[model samples]
Target chain A: MNLVLRAACVYMALLFVFRVAGKRSLVTVTTFDFLLLLIISECTQQALLGQDYSVTGAIILVGTLVSLELGLSWLKCRSTRFERWLDGTPLVIIEDGRILRERLAWLSVDEEDILEAAHVQHGLLRLDQIRYAIVERNGAIAIIPWREGG
Target chain B: MVEIKRAGDLETSEDLAFERTSRRVRRVARSLLYVFVLLAALGLFGDGPLSHARAGHESGFFVRYERFARVDGTTRFQIHPHPGSSAAPRRLFVSTSLFERGHVEQFVPEPASVEIAADRSIITFPRVESGGFVVLVMRPLRPGALRFSLGEEGGPTLDLALFVYP
Candidate 1:
């Protein structure tokens, strides 16, 4: 088996597992999520590269991983619930021109990081200008500006 | 009644547009699937030996020495010969920016002479003895690839590979 194909297989398996585990599994990657990722990678490494430890084994493993990722993406497009579950629904971190400090801390993010992301995305220089801020599932922060009329 | 009829017609057109968009997306998805399958098939069944051979060929003539201890303000080259080659002394000429401040030294049974030119960047070693399997430490000033030539000018060339360890 090619390394990529093996890697693809492992990746697809992981994606399927995550999808089955529900939206929360991917929504907030806690310490548990990190551990799962590490373990999966370790297992996949052995399966892809094999115990032989040769360059050929390594290539086949990588191929498997790529194939798996492609397959999962295809599946994700066909299912909205699966997409939401794996990718997570974006969480509103700031509302009504007020910072949701609790949610930020919960996501293991700092004020500086959110501020920088907001500034880069929306030219939001101050927290007061932001009507709503969302912590996206893909580990990104988005800020919506306060409307002038309302 | 005419307004109602117009609304129905607009609804039908919107539905048609959605259907067309969906069809285009599905077509793109199918094409992508075919490409992925083709790549997988190629990786599995096509020219496996050829790929390995190519990797091996590329690995030749390139020596990589990584993460060796760096002495204060000195760059070093650690040359290790490929497996199963005869151990013999070969002349070497190194041309690189690495020797900007320092000089090259070879550690063998015999004492070797190192001559740095007036430019201070270029160093010439006439003959450096290699005692079978041993590491030669050369301290060059700069940190980069140092090209080494292994024989006298217009003389029969010998097989010697150069590697830098920083």
Candidate 2:
């Protein structure tokens, strides 16, 4: 009972914190961010396990966390509003050879980020060559290039 | 705002209105996160400058303890016994709740003898000058508010409470 309760509480707390931190924060991870993630996991492990070091305790905690994740996914599938709120929707940051400066600023994405995404995804050189750029729900930028004359 | 259309073959739901509101909410939440971290650093949630506290008159009978402590983490408290006649033994009394919740790990200036009772435990120390003190180290067994007391026998007993964080 203690194991399950601990797991559920930790899972909910982490989920809320990570969601509030914004998707862009983890999409591009620096070395420091990776170190921070490791430290966070270590702290979480101590809270979840407490003094129990048995195999059964570990199994129970894992099961509880997995079950909670599955339950949330099920709930997300049932409601589009919930899905949008939890996972967010794709945002169009660039449209018709123009960059949406306001949206870029809100997302902390600079012109350099868009250019890098454009260079890697499509060999496009200039912003004029790109027709649209969408920031996906998973925080990856997707670029669409203008095709030859119709 | 630019009008967004679902023109591509890729399956994606483009909701600029929701995205805008979500970003605003995210900004607000980020501000809250900053406050939370600041408070934690100041020891509002656990051990820090704010957690260290003292109670009672230090000149006579007093105690120094942490306002906040971690479960299973070692914490130390000092008790200054009131000065009495030179030949009289200095005795200190501790509430049994301290024994139950606070797993007493060590004691400095070991007591000459300890008498366990149903409500409280009486600790006797050899006769010493007035300014001397004793230190008790404890590892809390659980979280939540722990109420305890320490005082010289038949003298002023000080009641104290500390919160243990998990």
Candidate 3:
């Protein structure tokens, strides 16, 4: 029971923290972020186990975490807005050779990021050649080029 | 400065769709954040500040310790350990800040094995087998919710609200 309680509390805390930190902080997976993630895992260990290292306690903790995650998944499926809130919605960074500066700034992203994605993904040399650049919900950039006829 | 075109002239059908969706997401995210903050506040209120923020609630046999104390004031409380099949003496750990610099009454039983942490607030009982009521009277030095756990720190804690009187 203590284990379950600990697991639930830890899960809630971690979830809120991750949410506030934003997906960009995680998706890139920089070396510093990796270290930070490791340290967070280490810190949560004591909070979850507490003074009890019994096998029963370990089982309860693991079970509770898994159950909570599964429950969130179920909640997400049932609620579209919840899914969007948790994962964020995709945004148009560029439309018809014009950059959405406000949108990019809101995400802490710059023109260089979109250009890099454009160059790498679409092999487009010039920014004007691209009709649209989008910041996906998963923090990846997607570039769309203007069609030959249009 | 990065060149940014006005949304009114530059936005296409696709851009409008993305903007609408993003606005919905922003609203949802704000609401979610507010909800989470409220939940966190409620949890902090329900659990003691020094309870180590465990993910679970206390289950199993527990002892009811003093739930309130005052700074520089006398408090008398009884700990009644719920009986179980095992009659073994249960160890009690009082990580309570109330014990810091406070004086335990003379009548309180001497714990078989005890340790007062360096900060002087945390008290540990290595072995306490008494299944009956153990009454404790103390004159607390500090005020605030004092955390007393059953086994050890991060264990099941009973927070005693303390209000200091000037």
| Best of the candidates, DockQ | 2
- The RMSD of every model to the true structure, in order and in angstroms, is 19.8, 3.2, 14.1
From the highest DockQ down, the ranking of the candidates is 2, 1, 3
lDDT for residue A146 in candidate 1, whole number 0-100: 74
**Fnat per predicted structure, each in turn:** 0.00, 0.69, 0.00
Please list, in the order the candidates appear, how each scores on TM-score for chain B only: 0.29, 0.82, 0.43
Please state what fraction of the native interface contacts candidate 1 reproduces: 0.00
Better of 1 and 3 by TM-score: 3
- The iRMS of model 2 comes to 5.8
* Model 2 Cα lDDT, one tens digit per residue, A68-104: 9899899887887888888888877887777889989
**DockQ of each model against the real complex?**
0.03, 0.53, 0.02
Q: Give the TM-score of candidate 2.
A: 0.89
lDDT by residue (B1-166, candidate 1, tens digit) is 0011122112111122332343454456557666755754453222222112110112222122222222222333333222222433333333333344235564432324444444222223323333222334555433333444332223332232223222
Segments in model 3 whose C-alpha atoms lie over 4 Å from true places: A148-150, B1-144, B147-166
* Per-residue lDDT over A62-118 for candidate 1, one digit per residue giving the tens place of the 0 to 100 score: 555566667757867887555544554455667666676776654556667667777
Q: Rate the local accuracy (lDDT) of all candidates.
A: 0.46, 0.83, 0.60
Model 2's DockQ score = 0.53
**Best-to-worst ranking by lDDT:** 2, 3, 1
